[model samples]
Target: MRGLWRAHRWTVASGALLGLSGALLAVWGNPVNTGICISCFLENAAGALGLHGNPRMQYIRPELLGFFLGSAAAAVLAREFRARARGPGLHLLGLGFLMAVGSAVFIGCPVKAMLRLAGGDLTAVAGAVGLVAGVRLGIALLGRGELGLGGPERPAPVLVPAGVVVAVAVLAGLAFVPGALIESRTGGGAQHAPAAVSLVAGLVLGAACQRTRFCITGAVRDAFLLRAAAPAAAVVAVVAAAVLVNAFTGSFSVGYYDQPGAHLQWAWSALGMGLVGLVAVIAGGCPFRQIIRAGEGDLDAATVCVGMVLGAALVQSWGLGGTTAGVPPAGRVAVLLGLAGVLGLALTRKERIA
Candidate 1:
């Protein structure tokens, strides 16, 4: 496995495969253009658990479970399962929550934003611009000695895997059970890809990403700031593969204002992802990275995941998220708050890595 990852072609090919497979899965299923959105899936899971009563967006996504489990397996096998934390736990939790809210406002994470664009959602282009702008801003902050939140202290050996096991068990139970809290009968909320397929996709993507260190934000950031082309090349590979698959499957539609499950407002889309880019950089990785880190026993990443789940619930409960029309007022406010939070962190921190 290590030998394969050391080969650049293998790593890029695996990433492209993960992206293509995930996109194909979404098209085959009824998740619209979204193949495997970390934030959206987490939000759906939160709604499925009755965290919020958003009927159209409730379901336990199997992909998420596969992600953690796959990453865990890789970590264990690779001897990379180091349990460690660095900074304040609660603050990271707050940042994660804000990041989730911002992502919800845009209706996608960095990965989904790219997928959305590849599927011909013009609004995703705005979000992509915002994401790059945010990352650029973050880089500037780093130049100014702006430090962000660190990790938490490592815990006992049993705690990390035990936590992951508990999370997996809960997700598995939700996948099988169908009660009022589970929302299995609803057409929209209960809709899901076949559990087996979702799990397999997640497992493959997670393991490959763990080996190759694939990150959407890092891809763009490296290209724009560091003058590196490798990360960006991987992103282009995924985008090309996904676009081809989506076109072949009749899933490619062009337009910004009326994409399925996406809003048309260009401003908010950009700002929402701008917030995500800033916060993610401050947090030391994108949402995907955070998930993998959580699997590797980073409690801070776990806290961020919790924040995403809670933020999903809050967005639904407060009507702060969007459907197809546009972002709610509260959702806009959430994005602003995210921007403020990240800026505050950037300004206040003492150490500068850039």
Candidate 2:
């Protein structure tokens, strides 16, 4: 098992498998235009709690529950489940919130941005460019020794699993007993793929991602900064696999502007992801990495994940998120605030460069 894990081919293959499976799951009826989005799922879950009233997007997503649990299981099995913290709490939470807000403005995270592109959303191209720009900026900050918040000292071993259990219970309850507060009757909001299928897919993908350490931000960062092609290669494999599946499933549409559930504003899309990329670099991992780390018992990552969920809720509730028609007023303001925050973090940090 160790030998197989150490092999580069195995890692790449697993990443490809994860990407293909996630895309297929989306095509199979997970959510139209949102097969596997952590941010989107969190937003949906928040709406399920009556945090927001967007009826078409409210539901308890099984995939998210599967992510934490799958990661926990893998960590335990691999003997790598060590609870730890590295940076400050409040700062991490703030960054996580900003990341979520930025992502909402663009309507996806770095992973979903790639998926959106593969699904023929041209707006994602701009988002991709933004991601690259943000990563580059982060690299520059790192060169100057500009680091953001640090975490707590002690780590709680049970927090992750406990959280997962609670989430699962919530989802199960919602699935079985319809609540008046829960928006289960909205058009795009109330729809969901089969719970069994979504759970299975999340499990598979989570385990695969945990094993391979797949991260979109890290892939781009390593490629540009370290000149290493391995992580980038993994991304290529996933993209290729997803594109193939999308084509096979007749989910492929080619264009930047006319894709489903996407707006044509190129600049904002780019800026939105750029903000995410920058903060992710400062945070020490991409959003996907954070999810995987939370599985491995990293409390800081878990905090970030929590912040992301809250941020999603705040964005949707305040009308700060984007839609297919265009960027919302609140979303625009959130983007501006995010950009300002990043710049402030960069400028205010006192670091000693070698």
Candidate 3:
């Protein structure tokens, strides 16, 4: 197994691990079809930090903390740990905000979209389609050599931010330290596997992804632009494994109606994910990848993380997120506005020489 990983079979191995982890998370306790949603987990993390007053979503999910620590450990061991600056700061912040907004509008990011589909929510098909379309739009701009961030830092200083993240994780874990923090009493917030299990799963995933440089955005982008199949194949493997596991464990439910944490508005799902796809392309990674990047000491990725938390708060406070009935009018408007913002950025940003 170690030899396979060393030889660059990281994709298949990590994909299988992700699939198994999702299935186990579902069996262990997470909202149905939402074993490990990057957006949802971030919102939950925000709520845990008292960033918002959403009781139902407030809890310190160890999975998120594990992603950071696990990746950091792997990077350090591999001698790949380095801190880098991301430029066009204000623009990157805006793009991150829009990315979160879009994800909230749909109640899922790319990972959740795929997981939802694996669990038999046919509505996710719309989201998947939108994701593809959005990626294609970004590709069009890339073809013109627009929307690039500047070069990497020469002397990378990674430890400081990594230490900060570790501190935050420790504080987050204090939720279990006997009344040190508020916790969700019911619903999705109430559901979770043991902290140890979730954290370990996250750590394994983080390490594998870091080693392989895995990014869902990169997967789609490479598949379309470079005709690369490895990343895309990894995605397929995950989906297949998730589907199989869910079916075997009776976690899979066919059809779309009354799916937990999901609305049936087809157009909103498509449009919301489309917005996510655009911003993810602009930001250079999906939500989870951004988190991993932050763990690796990219300050800009940290900026995006903050934006995502703010976006979650904004949606919840303004009632712009989807509910069981359907997508809210406010969410619909947000998606449209987000797309417009992305378009403006794409046109105005100077082309970067990579």
Candidate 4:
């Protein structure tokens, strides 16, 4: 136990921070079990940008900008901010798009799935299973040399970081300007903690995540392929912290029926999250990780982030998002197609099997 603690102390700390912040975000005013949803925030931000016309989902989430800016700040301060691009840009973007689709179908990302579970939503169980399966599959392919992403990573122009930083600044500025962004007055998007509070939460979590490299899918990957002690410890820390906070705040509930922001389609949820796991492995991080990497001037990750926003917009505009009632037919088909498409893409990048 002492050895495990030393191995994952930073990861555990960061994970606990995320868990506590996630539950408290809702307590402070954000939607239930949605303290930190990358896909949901993308949907809201997309609507705010008029990429989609979902009024109930339109709002500029300061947490998104906070994540980006905070990560950039951390990377710059640590001298880890390198402008680099690798692999096929369009393909990497597709991974991000697929991640958005999967999260939309599951009604949340892996992080939110865990938050839901911490709140005692059993429906998230299927999602957790699917996520692990996907991560395991990704690892299998990677180990077998079937994933052809192995190549020399090329360095991008140093000016790339400047442009990315400027973009983050503009978005952060917009979050503060009155009427600069679309604010939803009716639905989940309308229900949010104070902008300043949410942004601070995102900043602290984002910076911590950057330093610790704490990622949901990455933890799953580590647990499956590498050392289990650290990843397991971090995962437990997140769920335990969230559970404790929820129970304290009267938000914890037993059973899964009628849970907030969740659906009963367990099979589909698994499949959707499975897609997320697969892409995170292929893309080098989950949606949240992609945003952090983008902040650090990784063009590959930046492309994925752009794809995520586009996917978020397309899902709503095309009515491909799941809902409390159930997953839409369109969303279902999209998830199936996304799985097939991403798998095909990964195959194309494969080398020889060992």
Q: Best candidate per lDDT, number?
A: 4
Task: Give TM-scores for every candidate, taking all chains together and pairing residue i with residue i.
Answer: 0.91, 0.91, 0.92, 0.96
Best by TM-score: 4
Tens-digit lDDT string for candidate 4 (3-25): 76687789889889989999999
User: How are the candidates ranked when ordered by TM-score, highest leading?
Assistant: 4, 3, 1, 2
RMSD of 4: 1.6
Candidate 4 structure lDDT: 0.87
Off by over 4 Å in 1: 1-11, 151-158, 178-181, 350-354
Instruction: Write model 2 residue lDDT over 1-354, tens digit each, in one string.
Output: 344334556667866876687688777776555777777888887888777777777887777767766776787889877877777778888888988888887888887887787777776888889998999898888875746644345756676545654665466545545563365675655667787887777777777777767788887887787566665676777667888889998888888656776788888888888889999998877777788878777878888888888898898878887888889877888888888977877687677574
Q: Which segments of candidate 2 are over 4 A away from where they belong? A: 1-8, 149-183
Tell me the alpha-carbon RMSD of every candidate: 3.0, 3.0, 2.9, 1.6
Clashes of 2: 10
> On residues 251-305, what C-alpha lDDT tens digit does candidate 1 reach at each position?
8888866787788887998898888888777777788778877777776777788
CA lDDT of 11 in candidate 1? 50
Q: Model 2, 136: alpha-carbon shift in Å?
A: 1.3
Stretches of candidate 3 above 4 Å error?
A: 1-8, 146-156, 350-354
Instruction: Please give the lDDT score for candidate 3.
Output: 0.78
- Model 3: per-residue Cα lDDT at residue 177: 84
Model 2 pairs in collision: 56-188, 56-189, 57-189, 86-151, 87-150, 87-151, 88-150, 88-151, 122-256, 320-331
lDDT of every model, 2 decimals:
0.76, 0.77, 0.78, 0.87
Which ten-residue region of model 4 has the weakest summed lDDT? 143-152
